[model samples]
Target chain A: AQRVTQPEKLLSVFKGAPVELKCNYSYSGSPELFWYVQYSRQRLQLLLRHISRESIKGFTADLNKGETSFHLKKPFAQEEDSAMYYCALSLMDSSYKLIFGSGTRLLVRP
Target chain B: EAGVTQFPSHSVIEKGQTVTLRCDPISGHDNLYWYRRVMGKEIKFLLHFVKESKQDESGMPNNRFLAERTGGTYSTLKVQPAELEDSGVYFCASSLSKAGGSYYNEQFFGPGTRLTVL
Candidate 1:
């Protein structure tokens, strides 16, 4: 079965502190992973994709096929970075359907 | 450029009642998808529409849920004899048509409709 797992329900960090939100997946085929963020009063939006290999909003995630992880990392966290993060897996069949994890709430304290 | 929109941001109804949720995708987007998030659970896919056609609906929970996209435009999801387990946040997303054979596009999501069952 294909599934995405986010171990932490809430991850707290102080401003300027390092932040890491863990995500793991179980799939037999090549997986396409994505990180989505939803801020207060905002719609869920794509933060980054493993395919892009780019950083957005000072956050980056690298896909490790051996470990089956796509953990999101940021060297310095900001107050605005506090939001609900979800790791999702896209089906390889090109259906464009996303399978999401339980999600992790990152709260950056001042 | 408007984003995807869902009607009735919140709805409270008793069990066994019927509710219809509407979703209007961004103008010109051909791929529309429906997802639901139960409390403390992952956001799960419900269905997918490609221009008035049900491209994939394997994610739909059961026969009680029916989704339709008339004229390849806006879509509607109707739940008959709703149950308590149906209560959750329903999200609608839209993306552009696939280019070549790769499906690499951002799916614009709506504000989502929160359904509550009494």
Candidate 2:
């Protein structure tokens, strides 16, 4: 079984400040990690994936096996970045069934 | 191309009433998935369909929930005698199949249907 943990329910940051959303996971096998974002009144969309090693909308995440974490980070936060973010983990044993975290609501105040 | 689309964006009904939600996946996508989120809970997988067949349904809550993708184009999830705990948002996602492959493709999601059972 796989489980995702997002400790923070709410995170606030000022515009132009750096931001980070922490995520941790417990899985016995190799894991595929992803970050999903949902804007107000919008559908959930994939932001980034550990397998791709890419960044989207100035946001990037690095998967650390030693730390059992995948933290999303942005050098400078923008008001548009405020949204609900979920961290998910998937194992091949489960046929790519995603186990999502409870989600963290990010607020960027200008 | 258009993204995945779901019908009956919102529905409200009595406890014993049956509700059916629809999902239209992107054209040419062979993999479809269903998920739901209850209040204060994480979004959990309900099932997965590959074309017209159910590939995986280990996450389905119970027999009260039935899903079908008859023609492999669109799918529907019917919840019979819904309980108060069934009130939540149901999301549908579609992705291209990568069968027998190690990597998985990204899934496109619909806006989701919000069901309220009183």
Q: Root-mean-square deviation of each candidate, in angstroms?
A: 0.8, 1.0
By lDDT, who's the top model here?
1
The residue-by-residue lDDT of candidate 2 on A13-102, one tens digit each, is: 999999999999999888899999999999999999999999899999999999999999999999999999999997685357789999
Question: Over the stretch B1-118, how does candidate 1's per-residue lDDT look in tens digits?
Answer: 7799999999999999999999999999999999999987999999999999999999999999999999999999999989999999999999998787655778899999999989
lDDT of 2 by residue, B11-115 (tens): 999999999999999999998999999999999999999899998999899999999999998999999989999999999999998767578788899999999
Quantify how close model 1 is to the true structure by its C-alpha RMSD in Å.
0.8
CAPRI quality level assigned to candidate 1 from its DockQ score: high
Candidate lDDT (C-alpha), each:
0.95, 0.94
CAPRI tier of model 2: medium
DockQ of structure 2: 0.79
